[model samples]
Target: MTPPAITGQVALVEDDYTLVINRGTEAGVVAGMVFAVSSGTGQVITDPESGRELGRLSREKLRVRVFDVQPLFARAHTFAETDSFYGLLRIPFVATDDVVTIDVGDPVEAIAIEGMGYRKEANGY
Candidate 1:
């Protein structure tokens, strides 16, 4: 029930469908923890005329369950799967689905943890 903290970034994704995150036991990451993975650099909104920065938009890419923990990293399984004929096609050679949403370098934060809000608005947190 510790306050939701910035855990880490997704460093890599194994071919076996495991996500390798930078946070680990030392950062309070533990088995059974769920992380809210971000889509990407996110969309940057700005003023059309002044070009002033308006805001950034981010979306929930996927949810992952941490099942293995190390001192420097953790391995997780995404809740969604890409396996249908369409899913399979996307997984192997496309960028039009949830599987494409998760990429290395995406932000990953523990969710459903104490202090972690269950729902997020369009604003990037």
Candidate 2:
């Protein structure tokens, strides 16, 4: 996994709502890694001058805490925080008009780096 990454993804969600994320032993995934689940459309940015792609703007869906780990993946579940409402992140000047849901392709990003401590700002990523 890239050091710049809070690397992970939602691999499976149990009927009981347990989340299986795609990061494990080899990927340096361990118990207690906090993951932020996001499900929203991202806008691709391109350089207006040269038409080069810059980056994508994404939205945070929710947060999950890992309680177990294995060789291929890890299991996670949700918790509450003041700013996170199920998955709705508060963004200034941006209006979210659609409903979001937990799904197969939704990204599950780790909230902390290995040593850099926790990053609470979603836009910093």
Candidate 3:
């Protein structure tokens, strides 16, 4: 099935990892829904020569798992990444792991159902 349309923005990113989204049950958001966060309109790509439009650059920032759905707001937490990055270091080729945090005011869109790929391994492997 297709993912839900992006109809919300992150209202806040709590210290405890809980995120408050502007959309909730009224916007077809339900508990256990997973949302993906990105840079939103904050970044854009443009041709340097023409100074013309190219496209908005949005990279997957973080994933959130919704738990409490209110009328105008829902609570969630940074869960996992829809995409992971791995880097090789030097001759030894050490692996590098990167974790993206959902910053406040970032655009959030429903992307998957909860438990779809929930990881039980520690450190969210």
Best by TM-score: 1
Query: Per-residue lDDT tens digits of candidate 3, residues 81-106?
Result: 43433212112112238645566678
Which scores better on TM-score, 1 or 2?
A: 1
lDDT of 1: 0.70
In order of lDDT, best first, we have 1, 2, 3
- The deviation in Å at residue 3 for candidate 2 is 5.6
Off by over 4 Å in 3: 1-4, 41-43, 47-51, 81-101, 115-125
Candidate 1, residue 73: the lDDT equals 96
Candidates 2 and 3 compared by lDDT, better number: 2
Ranking by TM-score: 1, 3, 2
lDDT tens digits by residue: candidate 1, 6-95: 458899998545789999888888786778788767689999999999888877777677879899899987543345564444332233
Candidate 2 lDDT at 29 equals: 74
TM-score of each: 0.67, 0.65, 0.66
| Of 1 and 3, the candidate ranking higher by TM-score | 1
